[model samples]
Target: MSLQWTIIATFLYAEIAFVLLLTLPIASPARWNKFFKSKFLAYISGQASIYFVVLIGVLILCLLDAIREMQKYSNIESTDHQHLDAEMQGNMRLFRAQRNFYISGIALFLLVVIRRLIQMICELAGLYAQSEANFRQAQSATVAAKTLLEKQGAGDEVAKKDIEDLRGQILLLEKELAKEKKDKEAVKSQAESLNREYDRLTEEHSKLQKKITIAGGDKKDN
Candidate 1:
């Protein structure tokens, strides 16, 4: 029984790990287009949450079935009970240990999901900070270029050269600003994806709650 349980646990862990490994591309900014990365990650996270609930429910059902079977085997045959047999007692202990192991494994898997979520948040924060710094630097460079252009006189050759240099500087700053805008757009796209996911999950939860309430009322009426 222990060996069987060990094999089952190993298989479940491997499957969960494989699903988690698919999230690796999310860490790379280059992997993000307008649609793929953020949407994919949100989908995976939402699916993971759904599966987590399902797996927990299955685990509980399995536990309840096991307990029911154990009770059947433990039925007293006479006025005085002899207690459960040694083998049955040992099997009970094994079942309990395996159940605990499975519960712990599921908890660990949840922690992995949460850790990945936190890591993603931190990465976004870092990227936002970098983008802000780039914007400020670009703004300062633009101000410097305007000041230089204003101070120069249009007649002197040296002043013409200075103006040309400033013009070049301003062009470079504009290119940098364009790049920053692109990055900002990418970030905005991701934020919108997250918002859409939040709305979807909220709607799903509300519907689920209503279904549960309706089912409970039906059960009481029956």
Candidate 2:
């Protein structure tokens, strides 16, 4: 039982040392700024460091008291079984106290470690969510831009088709204009021909009238 108690004490002290080492950076005022970004963290670290110091003092005192008790017990001569039983009872009480102290210390250390881990996890998750939101926004913008471009392309195609239709209409109008001009030229040529025929017939009629008058005069003289 004594040996077991000693082993438990040794293990508890070792665990305490390990926890202290792990907490050293958090507890150190000089190093606090490196890990913590908030005043709240600073305040929490200060409080936690004070608690850890008090717990260390208590554990040290308990270990010292346990050592003293063990020394005293060893010095006692085994006079009788009743005395032995009393000593055993005392030892049992000490063991129980030491066990409770070790358990509480370990629990406190684990709580602090777990809290820090959870904070880190939450921070990481927040960063990931923000990045994912930004990425989704960018993706949505890209899709919208693509959709806008497609609409513009469709508008351009429609405009080109309208331009082509306008060009075809212009060509048809030009052909009709050319045909009207050609018909107008044909009508003007036919009118000029009719005017020349009227002038030749009037000249022939005047010559025939002169010949008839001369013939009648000759008959009268005879």
Query: What total of clashing residue pairs does each candidate reach?
Result: 0, 0
lDDT of each: 0.66, 0.67
Poorly placed runs, candidate 2 (over 4 Å): 1-109, 216-222
Q: Which pairs in model 2 have colliding backbones? A: none
TM-score of each: 0.34, 0.53
**Model 1 steric clash total:** 0
lDDT of 2 by residue, 51-117 (tens): 7677566655655665666555544424445666787876676566555455545644554564575
> lDDT of candidate 1 vs native?
0.66
Q: Encode model 1's per-residue lDDT on 1-222: one tens digit a residue.
A: 556455546656765775565456644433332223376777776677687677666555645555565455445232254556855565676566557456445645655564565556557766876998999999999999988876664446777788999999999999999999999999999999999999999999999999999999999999
